[model samples]
Target: MSALVPALEVFLVFLRLGLTSFGGPVAHLGYYRAELVVRRGWFTEAGYAELVAVAQFLPGPASSQVGMASGLLRAGWPGLLAAWVGFTLPSAAVMFALALGMARWGEVEGAGWLAGLKVAAVAVVAQAVAGLWGQLVTDRRRAVLALGVAAALLVLPGAGAQVGALLVCALAGWHLLPAPQSTERGLPAVPVSRRVGATLLLVCGAGLVLLPLLAPLSEVWALLNATFRAGALVFGGGHVVLPLLEAGFVPALVSHEHFVAGYGAANAVPGPLFTFATFLGAAQTQMPPLWGAVIATLGVFLPGALLMAGTLPFWAVLAARPGARSALAGLNAGVVGLLLAALYTPVFTGGVRGPRDLAVAVLAYAALTAGRLPAWAVVLACAAVGWAVL
Candidate 1:
């Protein structure tokens, strides 16, 4: 009963989060930290930091992982399920509705708000890189490793090139980067019923592995499978998942324009950026609007549940391992590099197109960092600037 209380409360709170967590992964993190950590006594600051680290290592949406971790901390399996569903449902529903409207009305034109929205997105990611880097890349050697990784990602173009670069950087950081002077605390231990967790993991793993083989090959299945894969392999955060989804879906007939449009829209909406999957699923093929809605809803969120279920058994074990900790440290550095690259290329270069844009961005940054403005306020103010200027 005591455990259930927190889990139920988390479900309700995250339901609200899913509905109104606009501005993508970085923004979502800000909201979560603000709402859950600072405002609510749900988790300690250190505990939230640990969850962020662990979530970055896993291959799925980072926010979903954070929510799942929050759920696990509160309850057990039921709590995890509740968190995933609560966090995912609101955005999924909205994306599905948007998809239906898109089918009826055609590509949403004159959503001129996206221009400013994307700039805000950039500012948010830049802030994340700055904040996380200071926390994660404490030493000079680690900073050098981060810079080298950023360089490789910028220069290289190919299959797995970015991933390979990240792996190499992680290895370099692990071997060459100085260890923390004070030992880092390991993740909390959650004692689960071994049989139940193992059963859940096996079932989910098997279902995900076999779904494509058994199901009919079509655009729907492809989108579902691709999204599932994206949800599985995307470590770090939501922005990091973009490239993988672009590589997987765009080449296979998913329109780059639609994808970018969906991403832009997702940033405007409040919720997890994983809702981008919902958007993609709905727009995958020119199916009936209802079909699109249903398919997209299922496709986007199925992986969240499966990934959590499958990974549950190993959470305690993996968190306890020294090698895992070292690898996670490296991955954390890689994540910092990835965020840094995002800051430079798409976020910075694309957003700050001219002197006015630069001025707006600098002002926004100053407000966020120095003036201590709320994130949503900064975003809204920037949107106003984009409308007036751009």
Candidate 2:
């Protein structure tokens, strides 16, 4: 199908998902798989699995990256753009509103609502890690890799550390893990040329290096640089960006409490966790909050978009290779490890300040596991419980 024929379909589908897909990045992928792969037959099971593998390997939000890749497969670059914009619009807008509101009443509102949001985040992330553990960690080798990566990141936590851990995993997978026989089911061809993708990738790297240097000249430049670096470096998506961005802005551009609170509030929203950038930007005093949100959001997500553009054309060919498949399996295991580490530090320790908080998180997790309540509903339920008891 041509780009135009699929552009509207892509936008509408993602917009629907954006309004309702709430558990986090992993949950978002599940939603996409159910809707696009299972229900719609948009792609084969192998194709969907390959997208997840590629997205897990790339920096930025993995679910968003997968969604964009699906778009590229469906109708080239325009469809990719449409998919991102549609999926992100609802959460981005909600986050912008929260950012503006936080400037006025963050402390007051955070007492109850944000508290519940925090615990809710804890529960949601826990659920995601639990669900993904089985699907991704099917073998003893991968299980060991997950444990190893999680332990290493917990001890030496940062974006750089996370990247290093992933590299180690990839190398281990390459040498230690047995290579599989190639099952080169050809993937749907995207319209982007290899040359076009390469050029975009080069631009992304240059911008990553140049943006921060320009920060001294302009505040916006600095914000972009910080966000760009956050986007560019990192293996695990969503919760993993926490450390990268925390070191970048906390106690300088934004306060520690606000940074943490924004994370909690972000969970209550639908769409990509990267929209947390929107909140961080709005929290900034360097520029008008909305403008800050816009630029920061742009800066943080730019690398992933450019990388997707550069890589989509070549992803199918590379993913079909047996060695590449093994490496990606290791990478997914690494992400699962990162998720476990995050569950302990930021998701659990950060939110569960006391017994009451832990209780709330437990209830939320139970609700999520029950599958009776949607994520947004669970978030609201937690908020009510927090106000009444927490």
lDDT of 2 by residue, 1-390 (tens): 453878888999888878767657755775676567545778754456557666766888888988887887786777888898889989999888987776544354457665776677788777757766766677899899999999998899875787788878777777777654454332577788888989999999999878878989988888988899998885676888889999889978999989988997787677999999899999988889989998988888888888877887787567667887777667767877877887887667767889889888888888877764556577678777878777
What are the Cα lDDT values of the candidates?
Answer: 0.65, 0.78
lDDT of 1 by residue, 3-52 (tens): 67867887887887676455566456655665565456576443455566
- Worst-scoring 10-residue span by lDDT in model 1: 103-112
Candidate 2 TM-score, true structure as reference: 0.70
Candidate 2 structure lDDT: 0.78
Q: Give the clashing pairs for model 1.
A: 20-270, 21-270, 21-271, 22-270
Candidate 1, RMSD to the unseen true structure: 4.9
Report each candidate's C-alpha RMSD, comma-separated, in the order given: 4.9, 5.2
Task: Give the Å error, residue 74, model 1.
Answer: 4.6
> Stretches of candidate 2 above 4 Å error?
1-67, 70-75, 94-103, 180-191, 205-296, 370-374
